[model samples]
Target: MEEYPISFPMEKARTIFRCSVITYLRNYHRFAITAATFVGIPFTFAILITQAILPISDLLPIVYNRLRTLFFAAGFPPTSEFFFDLSLKLSQTITSLVLLLPFTFSFHLLAKTYVVRSFRNKNGSYMSTFISLFFTQIWNSFLVLSANSLSFFLVSFTFSCMEGFGFKSPNVIIFVSASGGVLYSILLAHAYIISNLALVCSGIEGSVGGGYIAILRACVLIRGRTATALALALPISMAMTAIEALFHYRVMRAYRNSNNITVIMAVEGILIAYLYSTIFVLDTVVNCLFYRSCKGLNLAKIDGLENCSGDDSAEEDMKNLI
Candidate 1:
């Protein structure tokens, strides 16, 4: 591979990334209020009505069966009857909406930050960004998120298929799953960065083409630095995963009563809603900062925010033309 000259304000960009995450944490109360109202409350209600409010035994049969089915067979579709039809006390439709709709809205809100922080400063109204993104950015993000989910499922299926052969052991399973998971995660993170950049380029700049073309353009712009980008991103992503897992384990153990699944789910919902509120902002803002550092560079300026120096001729040409 030919090396391309690239220069970016490494120290400054690093500061920006750290500062952005810090800023979100500092103001997390504001984000928490919104997430709690929308995501947390509804998710809690769904859990309470479907599982927790009832005795653990009531929900246990259904959950155990569902788990067994999923473990034994291919996973259900996103729109499976299994999701839509419940047999217990809750109305299946309302419960589904409570659990699903808020999350859908929340994702749009999260993705909006990619455009807001990239193009605007701290003083910008997050409310306005939420409104604007609902109309413009959400669909593209939906597509990208869907693609990522499908990709992950495919990777998981591939690993499962490999396991169907005579190659199954504890260490082997752990090693293969961890290795494949990391690779898949890194690739997905890159795609997410590109997808968000595509949305920003189109929404902010307006001439960057729409939909998959812009996303592909983003791919072209980030061709060389996948591993480097992952190096920066993976730490944060892994940290989020670890935190989520730790909390989950703690909650599960603490609420081990057989009749408390809803209570556990409700608590987890509140925790996750708040965590995601800040983390999503952190993720979108940091990735945008990375994209901006490489914004006008000629090389596929990626991952090397601190070490990306390259030809200015292409950048200058773009500036002149724009």
Candidate 2:
């Protein structure tokens, strides 16, 4: 039920960010290699699966046509039709990716938690971390995706309306794209805030659901300080965008001629995926920094933080909670 305050002022944010970058760099390097090892191999496997599916999907039609010819030669017309239908189904298997997105996001979150633990030597148990990752990723990804999709639809509709009103179509498209950028940036910042809140909640109360109040508070905070919140998200966004651009460029360019593109893409994808996960994890660290900073600012107003029995303090509260 706590309402988070407006975001820190831009100048103060910059100073905090400078300190954060140094803290991140100093902490991040120690885990950099290990995080890559743990996350990269599985990510490579995922990319290979992706690549295999694409070729398999493309070859399905040809394979189906050949099988149909053979079936016709064997004089079973209905069986040949079934083969054709099977081809369509097989070709569309890539669509299963939509379902996989949640898991993909989950794995990224899990890896990030381990990376943080590595930095702090916090003894984050793997199973507990994995559970937190699963819930955080599924919930955060679903909410952000829904928000972004709605924003995209609304912005696109507004652009269409502008065009209908005789505004230049290109101009309208540009404006909509810019607005979409802002919307996504803000929602992404909100997600970062909420996801970190989830982590803190889980750490404190042993349940991701305990984070709901904090996550709701983040929504209110973001709304009241949209520009500052968005600005805080800028670095994380830039890193992700850069990695995505590289991933697309390398994969597409390699696909133009090289048979080894699959291997290359698999390697590159894993690296980029880890890079993305690192940024998300770092965003969480930044959120913690922000939270502590805000708490410091409100010290005069708030006599003390409520005794929430966080993990570090739980052993002391055992007699009471029991």
Candidate 3:
């Protein structure tokens, strides 16, 4: 059998990420339009609605503004004090918590179509793939949210137990919280990763099971290369964070001088929405390409996929004999 990576090959992973970016660029315009139409406008409206009613609005960083200012949309209906407060908190919580999966749902078909065309060299029905991933993600969401809440609660409870046992020193509490939070973060991140892998695998394998089995299979597929994936994902994440911060600074400055409707903020919101859609699709493509590599699939036959493929027929033959 041919040797596979037992540890991450840093250089090869960079190459993989570069290729994914190229694929994204080729499909960028269409992807951006789809994102803005479905994900962008709706999310922007949600933010506006939430901010309008919530009296204490800084819950959202950077964009939060007072209701009486330019932040308020033109001609919004007036609400009673009780109703406005109730609506504000409810909308803000719901919008903040429930945004990602729904946005992903809107862009799923377009993303899968790009993959099927780009990697598989096949013309598959984008709508069908979108519909399938939609239902699959809904089921996956319950598992993910439940586990996250439970893990977080357990971590908090452990710290509470330590405090109860009289480890009441400030220094000790700080040490424990920092260390425990890091450990919890790593475990939760691992779970998140496999959950996404399961999502990609479900699309590839066309099996439902709410992505649970796919998550396990993905864990096996990703085995020694988790660090490789993270190495590639982190830099992009950092760059995106920097871009967001820069945009926020500009928006804050713009908000100071102008009381009229803010074009700068609107444009920033649209661009960020596009970037979010891009990142989600890019992550999916990366996992797909990596999974294909692990499977020893002959992807060279699939035009643009040549950049992503290797000669791994020997590994495939070995698996066949087994």
- Highest lDDT: which candidate? 3
User: Could you arrange the candidates by TM-score from highest to lowest?
Assistant: 3, 2, 1
Q: Which ten residues in a row have the lowest lDDT in candidate 1?
A: 299-308
Angstrom error at residue 103, model 1 = 2.5
* Backbone Cα, N, C clashes tallied per candidate: 11, 0, 0
Q: Please provide, for model 1 over 1-322, each residue's C-alpha lDDT reduced to its tens digit, 9 standing for 90 to 100.
A: 2223233334334443554454344445543455445444444333333333334444445654554465346532233333223222223322343445555466544545433434442334555555444544445555545655565466457556765785656566556555655665555666666666665544443433444655665677667655445555666677656655655455544566553657756667567545544455556555554555446422213232221223243333222211
Find the number of clashing residue pairs for candidate 2: 0
Model 3 spans > 4 angstroms off: 1-6, 25-95, 99-104, 108-118, 121-124, 208-210, 262-276, 298-322
- For candidate 3, report its TM-score: 0.65
Write model 2 residue lDDT over 169-224, tens digit each, in one string. Answer: 55544555566567755655666655665554444223443235445545544444
C-alpha lDDT (0 to 100) for residue 300 of candidate 3 = 31
Candidates by lDDT, descending order: 3, 2, 1
Candidate 2 displacement at residue 247 in angstroms: 2.9
What lDDT score belongs to each candidate, Candidate 1 first?
0.48, 0.50, 0.53
Candidates in order, TM-scores: namely 0.48, 0.54, 0.65
Expressed as tens digits, the lDDT of each residue in 1-322 for candidate 3 is 5444434367546556655555455556544455435644454344333333344444543222343232123222233242244234334544454444453465454454445334544434555555545555665666566665565456456656775686666666556556655665676667666666666666666544224666667778779768766766676567655645554455544564574547767787566545545565566666665666556653233454434224354223223311
